[model samples]
Target chain A: MRSTVREADRPWARQGAGQHEGRFALLLLLPAAVVVFGVVIWPVVRTLVVSLYDVDSAMPGSYPFVGLDNYVRVFQDDRFYTVLGHTMYFTLVSTFLELALGIAVALLLNAPLRARWLWRSIVVLPWALPTIVNGALWRWIYNGQYGALNGLLDTLGISETPTQWLGEPFLALNMVIIADVWKNTSIVVFFILAGLQTIPSDLYEAARVDGAGPWRAFWRLTIPMLAPSIAVVLILRTIEAFKVFDIIYVMTGGGPASGTQTIAFYTYLQAFSNQLFGYGAALAYLIVLAVFALAMVYLRILKQNQLAGVE
Target chain B: MKPTSPSSGSIAGIIAPRPTRRGLLVGGSALGLSGLLVACGVGGGGGKKGGGGSGSGSIRALFMQQAGYSEENIQEMTAAFMKANSGIKVTADFVSYEALHDKTVAAAPAGTYDVVLIDVIWPAEFGTKNIVADVTDRWPDDWKQQMLGGAVTTPQYDGKFYGVPWILDTKYLFYNTAQLEKAKVDAAELDTWDGVLTAARALKESGVKYPLIWSWQQAEALICDYTQLLGAFGGTFLDDAGQPAFNQGGGVAALEFMRQTIVDGLTNPASTQSLEEDVRRVFSSGQASIALNWTYMYGLANDPKESQIPGDVAVLQTPAGPVGRPGVNGSMALALTATSENQDAGWKYIEYLTSQPVQDKYALSSLPVWESSYDDPKVVETNPAVVPQAKKQLGDMILRPQVASYNAMSQVLQAEIQKALLGDKEPQQALDDAASEAAKLLES
Candidate 1:
């Protein structure tokens, strides 16, 4: 230690050791940095640039630069507003239901129970399956004529006439929400459950001693304790729901009158299907700004928590 | 309880930094804005898009897997093509019909494919955008005359030949023969739209809940079905000055006729959600007695493994409306990609695939486009039931509007048409709304 420690205390030797470890750590991170730059940073920059041009074709060509025109056009589009309304409704309803159901499930799971591991494992299964698979499964189930839903309804003798689950616009959108909630609620439950465990048992006991009922305790204690987890889950689910595409693509193809068309799906149609890449790029940037605003809200909550010494 | 070190570089500050919202937003926005400006023109090459190369080399082709040539048939054809032209090697990629257009467009800039199979509706879009090579000079003069009229017109846009028409197709009326027999509806009674409705009513009375099914989903499939009916009812997509005319007269009538069938419970309510494949499955399972589908469906629907009513399936030309009977031209063609370096080789591959001998061999899967091949005893023997209808119907095919904005226009129409079918809007109002929207698209 005296011969080598000399390095720990000596400035020159310490600097040399730090340099060596820093270089090695940097080398290890190089691949990840390259991937992020290539996929995320590069595409984002290019999309922003593309949004400023009238580049219609995917092929390389001379295009007219129309700075900020596409962004202005986004506000003027009637279809854009229609799809935006749908996306907002989809996000608000889906997230609210998921949070409510997730908290309930998380409390149940957190409670002392039989086969806790087995129940926890079962709860994670829906989240384990990919969204696309879940969508296809739900689509088949919702098929109007030969779907499992109709078959089940018939067998249960609840309805004689087959309901066209994905046939009408409004009904199809709600059905898709039901499908999305079934799959995504599992993740929310896990997040809430993790938060639930961090809640001290003494808080509930003290609330009880103070003459608080179970509901009052949950409202006053459990909910306040779960704020950070709720904020985290809210941001994640909100962004994802706002950008919902694959599930809609598989289940509905934005149809029965473009009923389930989200902003992302609409952008895909503009960019790929309609070859309006410039317009699509602008739409994409708007989505980013929207998600950024949501993240801002989350960060504000996080800052508040830190200031209150709640962490 | 604890004093805070404000310096962000300190360990305590770094562990849980109290970054203000304004600072982060401003930082992120500046970073994004700087990157955007710096990256401007990164994707632009200003390079010319179309050319050809030496006549022989490796070539790749893109084809739709769902319809037209079966993937197995295509592979076999490619193998034979390569065998004959040893100087050229061929690689074929298959996607669903829904994916074919986007894949071709995405691959165009990179020159990923040497050849691509294009739907009849895409010639205008591809040709105008230069995604496909203009091969008018390469197309032989005699080949045009030798091909069926519908097939000859398939690859044409603004008087230019964009490709070689290969898979000739039109939707033909397919019905369950045994069911029609049980309903005592004569096959000849299905000749006209009026008579067809009467037959559907009789079939419905004969215990069929919905006697008619259609490929009427909110998709291009719906447009194809609509186009056939639009032509039958004497509606033109555009007038002489290129103004939208589908809102008037026959267009509204065709839509009304469609809606009336649903209101009468003759057409399946699920038709609003079904594509060609769904219609095939419904008819094959004996759930629906009548449907309109392409030539390939005849083979699949009559196969014992694919259909429950295999031996009882029958085919006929599309029923006539007040004006005439014209099936939707659901044909596709083979074209050289504009960005292909091996375009000469690609054209050679296309020629081989579209060759009369090659088409005649796969007659069971898709009928030949060559006019003379229809008369070939060998071709007729491949499928006796569909051949006669093909002979009559192929000559009378109707095309959708050939415009660069056809896809967008079709989407507008698809939505409004679905509204009418679902009884949300009246037929006239729906068509009117669609026409207004399509007019704006066409103008742009």
Candidate 2:
């Protein structure tokens, strides 16, 4: 009887009550497992397979198996490089601006104030708006003829002419980043605000006892404490900025000489508009590889911060 | 998958007679993935059509929104068609014109739509791709003679009828009579491109900042506007052998003419980023004195509720160049999707919609494709300002190059042309760049 009990200790031996618990857990997990496998795993693997072929149409037909050629083509194409440059510029600028602005606003929101809820709600309005609506709103504001931005500028006696904000390529890209930061900084602020609440007043008091001022205390105590949160927001915003598409679609449509085209938007143009599905799939995988590398960096920084806290 | 002990992980469980439950999970996923990959490989193999159905089932159709026909108008027409043909029920879906092409392409493999409204430029791509059915055999011979000459060619590709023309349209020169008169510029001078420029200068001198606004945004609208000017300058999109010819002779001249307008500040700098709707708004608001847009603009620009200077708006055929004037063909057609299961019912629905009586009834919303509708007193009365202009403009129309890869080529040209319009490149250099890029697209 004792030997029989020992046999159950072997992993997956299926001879005792532990087997039931394992099976029950699996049973409970089946729905979520199916969802992840069907929508996420399956499509990802299928796209990988498609990237190996020379597919030109959505309708099924004979297509030559050209392994790695499509991926190779992505590097060779001139427009790919052009769009990649635009995407990198957009991501870096937008993410940096969001982080800086998010921190400042988060500090403000975390401060003791009258009607804090009303202030927070008003600040959250832009973030609560759907990206499509935000994009359309900004497009209206940037309209060369009658945009509100120009109207305001004229009212303030700042300019004599209505500038065509979206008429130039580089300028259009920067303008889109401003629109993105304006909306996304809200999410970043909420994250930092939550991080702020987790901090104890003892740290600031202790810093004061050590003869440090408010600015030094903040830099020494608040920032270090918020490293984990900053790392989290950084990763989320970085990945999101890399995948930007819809706002550009609604606002610029990748126009003014394709000045504002990002990697995702270009992928869409290739797959749906140009019907080059295989090439588009290859581009998607490259994006995954790039994002994977980025995530690794973020995780390492998060782990380092955790270790420092533990010390 | 949940994180478990590595010693009892999926790979180990499968290899060691499933040491852990993780093995079972991993093994199952691998099997499923392999199966899916196999299925996908088969789909990429040669496949047969799945478009046959009993001609009487309910069919779904796709149409454009806020353009040729409003969603309300198309739905009303569909309801009328269903009432007449009691055996068939039609479901209509509408998307903006900007999304129409991609939406149709994405829906093809699934047979999600039985019929789709396609633009005039899509026949070449859709016919060759087997996305839309060729209906040349089913097309009535007499119907060809009945439709206007330009309308008849809307869906023709490589000697086959891919669709039936439904919405007939073209860009016409619309002007503000009040602004032109205030500038002392004769309306008669608007008949020629040269005279139109002189008129623009006069309008500018009279305090009109910009006298001309065009639908020159980076879209198909820009290509349409360009095609009109290309034709007026005696340029062909492709030479007889089908090589890129737009880089030579009249093509270069036409682009230069466009650039000069921008330099002179006679054409709105905003025109580089404006679509047809924007053109209408500026012209109607008296910010612009002369513009080019579709027939629909005439109705809206002359309506008091929509426009500030309603009574001052007038319409004319596109102005002549050094050569002759030819308007860009901006037509749409109804086509049976290649993957549709109920082609017979779909054809019946299309036939009813394109019928003269139905189209004539909707003349207030969109122009009729039938030439005889122009002669009808009621149709003329529906849009008196535009009907006479349409009679002349619709007779001479220029089509974008009928090529399978026209969309990609158009995108390249749009970007290059924009570069020229914005002063980043010379017009000659821009078209030359576009021509070289087009050559590669044609080869593929």
Candidate 3:
């Protein structure tokens, strides 16, 4: 009777071994799933939930569910639109300037210039410096009374009086962009230089044989080949510029009026300065949507360009 | 051997007897969950133990950045407090003015601080939210007369005092004595807005280029400057019914006067971007003949090591306008938090920090809130020019609205005033917009 009972459980036991291996695999993956759920998924859900309520920090338990009213208020705010315009202006102008300067510098670095290694090393120092340090450095350089820039302009006989680089509205944004370009162009240069290195020498030789000058070869071969790298830089810089706060906060405090108040600065003012968390959250989500849409457009362009290149 | 069915006896049955797959899965999952739960429980327990046990003896105090309230001074004060209270320890933290209110609001709920440096205008919000404890009956019987009347009342909400006023502060009109003498303008003639502008004209004639420098940056300083001017012109920001009335009365005239200062080049065009420190630097550098700045600049400008014009500085009452001479209170106070576990120790620390002797010691850097400290020998000797003017200014000082909504109101007013200053909007339209927006914020 003992032998018969053992025989009956044998098939079930053999099958259990194979199934237990699968169970072990799932157990290994459980911690990773828990971490992803906690870290990535949770805050997003919380932000969304909080966005739909009028959250008063002083009265914690008394948040009223306001549906989409907060979003409506953000849209109705004139400051929101003004800030959005300024953000776009800053992103496009700064990114374009960075890209243009970056390509030129990268090409120079690629050339057989004297002390090429030293130049390559020194070019990245600006990018390596802390952003706060850069902001402070530029602030002193652009001071209306005691700025190096004003001193230079005076010495060069550019203007008689000091230009209020950070006080005038258009001038302030342009000055911030100049500082941003000085700090960020090096990153673009690094990326493009790497991309330039990946291109085959024979392609340039073929273009040269086809009676193309350096400028034409750059237009026809260099740019087309470097499209992917440029797209990546554009997408990264656009996202970064869209969310810029620190430089503006440090340089101008979004001031001389709200001339430099980007969407991010305005959102911070709403959420922290005004203590209007609901409105700020709604504004944040709108920024997220805008950024997501921008990213999608860049990705599509990259894909299409690759497809055209392949064909 | 043939693949054996478990139901029948075979070699496979003897080699592979095992637990069922379902049982193994359930057991493994339970073990993993329990491990995670145990880890979380351990962390939480450790945190609670730290907060409830050893941390109960030490208190943390948060302060806003100020000249007299340096980290070194704070450490000395903390050391003195700890020395007096044998077993207690105090930790200090400092934040800049821009981040002070926000940081305190965020930190208070977490019980992160036991004592906080409260802005004079913040008691209404802090008291209304129960962020700080009420100490209405804590003062000694003679405290009412001992402290300045405004200082005593500035931190009260609902007839309850929430803090002890520490620094007695207000704005002052500072001038370069050499520049005034060079321009041949009597200091008494520079007692009104017109007089200031006329003096600017005289200083300009004497080749000073920019005669009046203002701390007109679009920040709390701008609001302070505007409010002082508004009060000087006999304007009230809020009505008897607790409504915004800044756009009415002499508000436009006050704003226009500020705008004209820039327009007439009496103030540096760059003054629109200059903070109080910037204006002080401009004055100390002898680039400007007159400056409107905090009382701290007076001390700095007189010190030979700190000032370029050490022998050529004078401070006076914030010049009078159409109605009277008025200044805005920039006083800061210390408050005990309700959430602190060691409230008694926190109160002791505050009491010692604000005591007359300690305050007198700190008076060279920060004016003492106690009215009697002005007569303290050291204070009188160190800051002789500042004491009498500060005493007189503290008497006529007007307070910005002390309400829960003052921060939001100040922000709106600042933006509107900045627009007018930047030439984006006319003064009347700017005030009207600010009035309407601030009214809505107050209502909500």
Candidate 4:
């Protein structure tokens, strides 16, 4: 009888060992999972849930569930549409300009210049500066009265009158875009420069031997090789440009008749200004959707390019 | 391990052999259940702890940025309040004035802040939502009367007081004395819009880019310009019943005057979209010969470190309109929250901050709402540039309409005003459409 009891206890001991190991594994993973859930997943879930309610942030716990009402309201708002359009317009125009200018600058810097390191370091200065500081600097540059741009134009005899760059509704958006491109093009330049360094010099030599023009060589050899880097730059910049808030907020506050209002600014206004949390959450989701959609398009293009390369 | 299911064991054998297995299974299940329960308990505990600490513990106060007030002044005020009231500790969160409004509105529902300092115009919008407490019966009668007359009135909604006026801000016309002399236009002649425009034209002919610089973009300045001109034309924005009255004759004439000023080039095309701060920058940078801005700019414009033309600045009333002189009076108000645990303590802090003595100490930093403080010798000596004009204008001041729907209404009016300025729509059409939209917002 005593031997049978001892034999039954063997399975229990093995089971105890298995359970202890399982608990130990869970303890290690639990902390990381908690952190991820707390910081990332929870906020996303809360935002989604809040988006379904009509929340007036001024009244605590007063938001009653109103399924899809906030979403519908956001879609119907003319300002929403206008800001969304401006965001798309800003992202598309600025990203394209940054890519083109960045490539140009990178190509120039990649050449065997006399002081290549100094030139490269200096080119990175704009990108290295803080965004708010850059915004304030650009705001000073665009001032109608004492701005550097106007002063320069005045000195050059371009116009007797100073240009109201930020004050004009038509020009304010363009001025902000110009400032954004100037500051961010350096980032793209750095990426492209890295990509350019990885390309084999022998490919260029072969193109030259084949009597290829500089433009032809760039299109066929350089660009094709730099496709991955270009894809990364486009995706990163597209998402960033779509969510631009600080620079525009500081420079224009979506003013001169909301001409410069972007989707991000509109979301802030809805969330913080109007205290329409549900609507703000819905707008936030819309912005996420926009970025995701653009990412998908870029990913598709990248995959197609990869397929072409394989063929 | 073994063929365990062959036959049922006798009761004594089964009971004696299964103790280890039973103990392990029970312990493992108990631990798993306990872990799940602990995870579920955190949220409820956080809420209870937060609510429990509301009154006796520390409270957070959100304040708008003061133009010339330093962080040290804020610290001093907080220390004084804490020292006087030993039971409560206050923490101040200062943000830019524009951002402060949005922050308070957003933070209130989350119970993230216990007290908020708001613009006087904001209480109407916030009051209707019941974010601010009604303190009509809570305040002392003498203290209420001691505030600048219309300043206290701006925080009332439907005959109930929701906030206490803490500071006063009024618009004043700032002219360059040297520019007036250079243009050879008598400063005394600039009492009316036509007179000012004529002087501006003379100054423009004298090579000044913008002779009259004022922001028509949005906010209080727009309301001030509109009201000053409209009241001169004997116009009112709303009737006795708080309905739209801007479609009347006085309103049309006022809008036309603004348009003509832009068309005639007396005021710059840029002024149509410039803010008060932008216009102030133009003035401080020595570009504008004349500008209309708030009283706070007087200190910065006179400070040699910040301003190129320090002593050259002088203040006067906004140019009188055809019918009467209407100056837009702006004020900042402080309100305690209904959710505040320490209501009496919060009131005491408000009293201490707005007391005549404390207000006098901060007079140079911000315009005091206390009438007694304005009369203080130190206050008069400190803010000499516009104190006299501010005092006089306080009597004739016209506040922007404090309606429940003012926020939405202001946006619509601002957009239409911008449209009219840009020549996209006529003034009448703009006002009519704005009125229609405002009606919709009000009804909704």
lDDT of 1 by residue, B1-444 (tens): 233536878986876778799869965885676575534453456444556788888889999887677999999999988889989989899987878998998888788998999999999999988789999999999997899999999999999999999889999999999999999999999899999899999999999999999988888999898888889999988888887899998888899999999999999999988888889999999999999998889989989999899888989999999999999999999999888888888888999899999999999899998989988999999988889989999989888889998888988999899989988999999999999999999898
What CAPRI grade goes to candidate 3? Answer: incorrect
In the order shown, the candidates' DockQ scores are 0.48, 0.41, 0.19, 0.19
Name the better of 1 and 3 by TM-score.
Answer: 1
Worst 10 residues of 2 chain B by lDDT: B1-10
Candidate 4 TM-score on chain B? 0.83
Clashing pairs in 1: none
Predicted candidate 3 versus true structure: per-residue lDDT over B292-352, tens digit per residue: 8887888778778877899899888998888998898888889887667777778788889
In model 4, state the lDDT of residue A282: 93
Off by over 4 Å in 4: A1-26, A205-213, B1-59, B66-90, B109-112, B218-221, B338-344, B372-378, B383-385
Off by over 4 Å in 3: A1-39, A58-60, B1-56, B137-142
Lowest-sum lDDT 10-residue window in model 4 chain B: B42-51
Q: After superposition, how far is residue B32 of candidate 1 from its true place, in Å?
A: 9.0
For model 1, the stretches where C-alpha displacement exceeds 4 angstroms are A1-30, A298-311, B1-44, B47-57, B86-88
Ordered from best to worst TM-score, the candidate numbers read: 2, 1, 3, 4
Q: Candidate 4 residues B136-249, lDDT tens each?
A: 887778866777787778667778888777667767788888888888989887787778888888999988877777778644457667766787777888889878888778
For candidate 1, lDDT tens digit of each residue in A1-311? 35445555766655467789989998997898678777887788888888988878777766788999999999998899999999999999999999999999999999899999999999999999999899989988998888999999899999979999998999999999999999999999999999999988987898799999999888777887787788889889999999999999888889988888999999998888888889999999999999899789876875566446432
lDDT of each model, Cα atoms only?
A: 0.89, 0.89, 0.82, 0.77
TM for every model, in the order presented, reads 0.92, 0.93, 0.88, 0.85
